[model samples]
Target: MRFSIYLNAQTPGPQEDVGIIQTLARQAVEATRAGFHGVVLTEHHFSGYNTYGDNFMFAAHLASQVPPGTKFSLAVAVPPLHNPMRLAQQCNLLDILTGGELIVGFAAGGSPLEYAGMGRDPGERHAQMAHNLEILEAALAKKPEDPPLEWETAFEHGTLHTRIMPSAFHRQSPAFARATQSDSGAEWAGKKGWYLFSAREKPQALAGRWRLYKQALRAAHAEEVVQDRLDWSMVQKQVYLADTSERAEAEIRERLVLMADNQRRSFGHVKDLRDAAHLKSVVGVSPQNPDEFLDHAMLIGDPASVREQIREYEAAGIRHMAMLFNFGFMTPETADRSMRLFIDEVLPAFTG
Candidate 1:
């Protein structure tokens, strides 16, 4: 399996945000040097959910520093928020910059505030995303001689008379991935022979998603596409490494609670993850209750145990693991220690 770091940082307040963002940037450089195969980023805006709101620009900056082999994924970007032409141009340019080592994942959904900030209606996001994506595909496929497109939407409309300049480095346009928590990720992306990923899911439970996607791909695509797309599937986790499980748990205990409280305040008890009542009944842990959330949502242990957890994920068809080392108000220095330990001890078990 190939492992990568998911570069996401939390903001406790405006006071602490700047330092976290700087740390996150340095962590990207450190991770590439530490021998991770790739890196993943998510696009979040307005709420400080991601320390940086501009993933495309951040990725371009990273491409200059990370090793040539260090691939990148936008794991996702919200399509409805961008002008289609600009979005297409940005994706193609970034793809060229990465030497075609880019996967542009997209989803229709985003936070309501983000939609509002972009002057897009949340209720119309799906339609808007579809419209934007169609334009993007058309723009990517356009040749200089092609006729102009006349596009209109609720918010804006324009004509595109020329092909998107500086075409993608890849011959067949950039590889596309979809981000979704529902079966649609497989039903659409799988059948279309595209990559798909999800987060906040149990690694073991992802076996179901894997099976469904494989079934869908086998039914719709040729052998080469099926074989190539089948491997390198992604799984995300929050990771912390220590000499012993006891030490790992004790070190992360308070931080997890603080993170959970943010989730409760930001997302209203994180009902989307699961309400307190159902979470307690099914998993014996509330969404904001960090006591057992650590066990369920994170990968925390000694190097040996961490390696074993990764092995389980591999058996379940996860070839790409995107781990988050800094989270829940954790210090950069502390997270880097875990990352370096992972590189020196745990990674060799998998990589070598």
Candidate 2:
């Protein structure tokens, strides 16, 4: 199983503005030294979610400083907000800098606020996202002879044939889609025969999504994905560790509450994640007690306990587990401690 920490400062508010870069860099160094596989940063726009919205840029900067073995990735990027050519170039450059360790997670720019902030119409985002994705894929594939560019033609007085820069890593790096809620991600992942890194904290929802993914793959006739393809990871994330179950419960409460509240506010108005009728249920399932959430969403507890949980997920076909242990007010110290505990105790039990 592969383990990676999702990098983000606990809270970016005035009270806790120590910044994630310093802590994340330190954590990355520790993770690499400790033998963890990778670190993934998330991208968000115009939200207090994380002060650092440019995940690709941040990942690149961090990648340069990380220890030798640790890799870096952007969990998801708002595709419509970026020019595909420029985005591809930047990603390629990052991949080169990281020695070909880059896994791109593309998304259709969630959050209407991000779209509104960018002056993009939310209704047209999916189509626009599809267009941008095609351009990016074509650029990465080095299909330069392919033409009929619409977005570029409108901007040019005449004709402009532009190819992205630093395309060296185009053939080396792989890409994935962040499947959130809808089957759009599975459908697209299958359509492109690309990998899908599906993340769900909820087991039931995750099972449903996994089924949907298989269905989509079957529909698209996607070939058996290669394990070497970083994008094709079967990742199931949780906020868990090994200790007495009672002790685990005591440790994760406050942090979970803060995280759930932040989530409720972040996507509060976004109907895609939660409908009016289902909003309370969403929060209800989002454990007010971090340990309870851990029992359900995270893979934390005693060694025997966590092992059993992992076995269930492995049975469900999850090979890579992206454990989200550091969230809310989780200090870098605690986060590091959790990683150590998981590595030393919980990790050994599951070698599948």
Candidate 3:
């Protein structure tokens, strides 16, 4: 099994804006030193959901500071809002800078407000993302016999006779994953033989999705490819560890509520049907009990309790878990403290 820290750039207050970046950078370095396999950064725009609008740049900065083996995962770069060619170029540069430790994931972004702000139609995001993926895959192709690249979309129109410059240090593209819901997106990612990432879902639900993804992969690719990539999946969950369950609950309860409230605000404003459907799958209805919510949604407890909870996931055949430790307006100090305790007590049980 592998573990990763999912880093979200918190919305800093005006007075704290300058220092927040440095704080997050330090946290990334700390996570690396704490023996995490990788750091995954989320991307969001215009909303206070996240501050990392350009994850590639932030990842490159972190990569420069960390040792060569520390990997970087771009949780989900929105494809519809970017020019495919330029995005490929930036990814290549990041891969080179990180010594091939880059892992890229793409998604049709969920926020209608974000799409509106970018002068795009949120309803068309899936279609646009499909086209963008084609172009991106073509731009990153390394084989001489790969098909010629051609793209004609609202965001870009070009044909590349030559492969992208600064080829990835890896034999193929560094690594490609897709952020998928329990939707057609999972099947599409499986067809492409890409990795899978899901968030805020139960083990049973994720296991079902993984089964679907594997079935699709077998139908779309050779058996060898299917076998090699079947287990390259990750699930994300909010996690906080402390000396006691009571302490963990007291520390994270208010923040968890705040995080849910933030999601309500963002998802409540959805006007597009597609975004509404996505909101239904991700946020569902508002919760009445904070304790119940924490019990169901997050991993918050003492080291032994958290370890037991993670063991359930391992039993369900989950090989990678992305822990969202710095979320819901958590202070840097608290997040760091939780991470250190987890590293000291809980992580070794899994690693050893």
Q: What's each prediction's TM-score?
A: 0.88, 0.78, 0.87
Clashing pairs in 1: none
Q: What is the lDDT of residue 344 in candidate 3?
A: 91
> Cα lDDT for residue 274, model 1?
20
Rate residue 248 of model 1 by lDDT.
95
Give the Å error, residue 345, model 2: 0.9
Clashing pairs in 2: 238-298, 239-298, 240-300, 241-300, 241-301
Off by over 4 Å in 3: 142-150, 159-161, 215-231, 264-297
Model 2 local distance difference test score: 0.62
Whichever of 1 and 3 has more TM-score, that candidate is 1
**Candidate 3 per-residue C-alpha lDDT over 221-320 given as tens digits, one digit per residue, 9 for 90 to 100:** 9998876565457877789888899999897877867766766666666655355545433332233356656755678899999999898888776888
The digit string of per-residue lDDT tens for model 2 on 70-155 reads 65657677677886667777888877777777777776645555655666656666677777776676666654576734344111
Off by over 4 Å in 1: 267-296
Q: TM-score winner among the candidates?
A: 1
Q: Assess candidate 2 and give its TM-score to the true structure.
A: 0.78
RMSD of 2: 4.6
Worst lDDT run of 10 residues, candidate 3, spans 279-288
Overall lDDT per candidate, in order of appearance: 0.77, 0.62, 0.76
